[model samples]
Target chain A: MTADTTYKVPTMAEMAANGEEPEVLFWVGCAGSFDDRYKKVTVAFVKILNQVGVKFAVLGTEESCTGDPARRAGNEFLFQMQAVGNIQVLNGYGVKKIVTACPHCFNTLKNEYPELGGQYEVIHHSQFLQQLIDAGKITLKGGGTFKGRRITFHDSCYLGRANKVYEAPREVLQTLDADLVEMKRCRTKGLCCGAGGAQYFKEPEPGRKDINVERTEEALATGADTIAVACPFCMTMMTDGVKNKDREDSVKVYDLAELVAQAYSL
Target chain B: MVFFEQILFVLALAAAGWFLTRRIGLIRRAILLGRPEDRSDHPGERLNIMLRVAFGQKKMMTKPLVGLMHFVIYLGFIIINIEVLEIILDGIFGTHRLFAPYLGGVYPFIINTFEILALGVLLVCVGFLARRYVAKVARFQPERHREMGRWPRTDATLILVFEILLMTAFLTWNASDSLLRERGFGHYGELRGTVGSFVVSRFIEPLLSGLGDPGLVAVERFTWWFHILGILGFAVYLTYSKHLHIGLAFPNTYYSDLRPKGQIKNMPEITKEVQLALGIPGADPTEPPAEPGRFGAKDVRDLSWKNLMDAYSCTECGRCTAACPANLTGKKLSPRKIMMDTRDRLEDLQRGWQKTGPDFDDGKSLLGDYITAEEINACTTCQACVQECPVNINPLDIIQQLRRYRIMEEAQAPGSWNAMFSNIENNMAPWKFSPSDRFNWADQLKQ
Candidate 1:
């Protein structure tokens, strides 16, 4: 087993060289790769995995867009072109049992990839984390930073409604001993963060209110200091929403993975 | 004199047939303008869907009270139309109550049943009129619903009033004919003393008792003519009104996308292109097109026949808009409006083609003039609209196509979207970083 003290994370290429197959393929999605804020969530998730000693490896440079944004943006040609390349690589690797930090990635890899013959048991990171906690592999230190704080989760449309993963994130949050509150429009009725359907990469068409702003208003109305999220896209939108309300100083946004990492003190 | 009556009846019949055939032909031609699609697979599933959704009114029953009210009118309309068959025979043969002699014991039962249904249809229509004007159902109200403008609202009211008038005419005809039979007047008395009597028509007989035998005959003839003419007119008017759902619900439900609501259809042309690019040897090679077509749909002709059919099938019910997250959150998108816009654009194209031959262009397409970029962009693709549409209209399909055209064909995407596209093309992701550094987030995973 790789030691937690080492800085090097295992790559699928290295695993192939060592004649080893990981128990799970950690698909560190695009946001995990480059977005500064989401990268922290990625790190937190990795740390929890390391503490649990679950064998996992990433594609590193071999990873590409799942083509979700392209498809959603109406670029079917570009999306298919991208999807074909990724499917070829994943199939070549003989990878299975994939876990992803991004719900968009989880959705595409699980739901869309099967059409292209790239099938795997795909799980969102919150689900994988919940599984580890359920199996007693992840043990959190008592009286963590979020022990008694009010935390309201903002459901990612892809995660909650698209995939029906409402319980996993809440289960992970429960480990931090936080007082979890509910938004008026939670679970299936959850609103979008104004960043879905490639909206993250575009200026919103002129409207009375951006969806994220309205969603954040609901999150704030719950009077929760910490707004929890499961998807990186939700993290970005909710952070922006909190900031738009000028509550970044008081009402902080966090991913469930980030809270897990903090609780484990890894 | 009998010969002249038969001649007049034959001429009226010919005129109604001509008008009905002409209207049906126009609709068929207009729908055929849409590109061909193969929705013929899964015949069993399609038939099941047609029976449940259209015949059984399953989707309509999601809202119980409204569904029951709608079912009453729908059932009444169909059942009462059985009387129209006999009227047609009478008109052609110059025989009063043509089927009564042949039906014998069953004739009165059928007539009594028709009388009851006619009353039901009339009462339901009045209730609907009150709901639209007095009770003001939010879906029908004009202020909040952008598509429920003057003509659409008036069209709904007009259909209701027309039904009421037709029912009145039928009841008047039956009551007058019954009175003439009691007075032993000519052919009317030949069908007298039929076993099952008209309960509702007997009550209405007093209202027409003052008309003498000659006057009663005139009244019966006028109403009989009016009833048949009104039925013919309604059949033609449906092609213009949102009431086209009355006819289209069967085919619309049959052709509904049977896949999971969240699953978007793959573009076949794009799939082939991708397979060819990846050096997959099995891709059937075909002659490259002389010129590439537009990336996505820009007008009604570019949409699939199913989509065009969906446009024709819309009930303007606003269930889709009510469930739309975008509309709920104050965005410009309204799924009902999307369908309305598609149908309007289709009609405009058909009208233009009719006037100027096949090579016609109004220069006003579905994208800019009818449905705006703001509305299309506002969609979150949540499938809530798709889930709520009673007839399985997929407005999201049209929205996606329009967005695709804006991005790929016109290159009119927002500046930030351009950045995302560039990022994906270069870095294989939507970020401004190299792929090698993707694992750096794992660095802090160590103690």
Candidate 2:
């Protein structure tokens, strides 16, 4: 668990050898591996993929960081190392494509990695689920046919700004029978969920606006009953923000995967 | 009285001629302003206030000592021109003799005082040049990523020579006038004799008398014509050259905005008809009448005259260049080049536009290739360029507009964007996660 002198982030070669190919190389990312709450979603998502006969695999445990942090700090050299290392690992495993539940991993792999020669079929979990739905995949059983369960979506900056991925999640909301409300700064100008640039693991700048709380307040102002998020980072930050506002009972957070699971009565 | 009157008439005619030419071109350049509408989501109703920053040097003043130094030298050149007029009048009216052709007067002392001020101004210019070339403040360095080349060093050099010469002439005239005051009639002053006093101590008494010939008057007259005319000519040339920063200071300062820092402007749609009507769309900085105006800057001509003028006003200071994150992070984007590109292409555009009719546009296409989505998207929107811009041209707004055009209109984007966008519509997150248990974290976090 600790980075030793011999610390090496997991390699795709080792992942392939261990038969960790889980259809989508669902990169749990660093925060997922470290946070107990995030680890549960990854576990549950994996279990569902298994139940549905969706073949998949795990990656090298060394998938610790995406180096998005270093790049933003003007340290391009470190960014390149992480980029090359990950690409090499993925290439060694013959990973022609990857599916990630982490928005940071999704953005990094989908947008940034190509600069360092890492190119592949990459998808965020929401898009993958939507594809599965379109293919007449397992239909989720609606619990109480939860209609009018108004939920506002938080756009992670990387998912929105870095890649401009805006609408797929909304389509998921449409299918799940959840009423969708959008924040004022949705889509390309979408506000950050306050957990990016590897900020998921560190304290933000003091005296700076907490974008997550600001976004959560914006969502709350819309009178939405619940907040749905596709990224675990958004889920964590939104959950905390909701609690801090004492809106725990009035509003709540949900992961897209967990929502899909409940609808299918998994 | 008749002779004095004739001299005043001649001087008035020349000054009027120079003033007229200066006014026309500067007015035309300023009036032919363009504001490109490519990058923003502006409210379109708020004050531009950006102008205040450009004219105020407020942002530059953040680096206070450096800002104050440029301000002093900039204002000094402006004030000395009044003194220059006094010299020209003195020449024309034939007080033509400095210190009145009669020696030992209070007039010589006043003449000597102005010379000292000119020297003081010249020293300030020296300091600014050193800060840019030698001290190499990050703000003053080229914002090159791999260092393909450097900024044009010529602009700095010319301004220096121009100031030094003016100072030299003033000192020469002063020293010569002083000695002539000490000697007696027929002793005329020029630059060499002004400084020649220093050498006068070493020279024989014969040399001082030798310097007093009518030839010394010719010497004074010759250096006076060249130095004064040279500075004046440089002033006129700067109105059209990259050294236009000289002309840019006051107007640029007067128009600068003092509003919120780097605030985003909300944009409105510009209609196609407006382009046809105005002959260019998306270039007006002010609001269009209630109608769909230009959606975005269709070409460079569609830029506002202010935006176009912003190009000429640059001193090639490299402040914006040093601050661009994309440039720093090794992306092919430099804010400085964007401004420089604006100025460089103007001539070619003018050549083409002039030869053609009113719709005579050289096409804003030059910037099209240079400010591509790749370069635009690479920017982190960090406001470094905005913060570092010596004249406060917000490259961030331009980059964003270019990006919007690339995304919304051209549909040109990176391959990964397709997958990312699909996920947003499909899974409600960029990640294709299952929707059934999005809240499962609630149960697991009990520990």
Clash tally, candidates in order: 0, 88
Evaluate candidate 2 by giving its C-alpha RMSD to the native, one decimal: 19.5
Interface RMSD of each: 2.2, 16.9
TM-score (C-alpha, index-matched) for candidate 2: 0.52
Residue B284 in candidate 2, Cα distance off native in Å = 26
Residue B194 deviation, candidate 2, in Å?
Answer: 18
- Candidate closest to the true structure, highest lDDT: 1
Query: B122-142, model 1: which lDDT tens digit per residue?
Result: 998999899988999887787
Interface RMSD of 1: 2.2
Query: Model 1: DockQ against the native?
Result: 0.44
User: Native contact fraction of candidate 2?
Assistant: 0.00
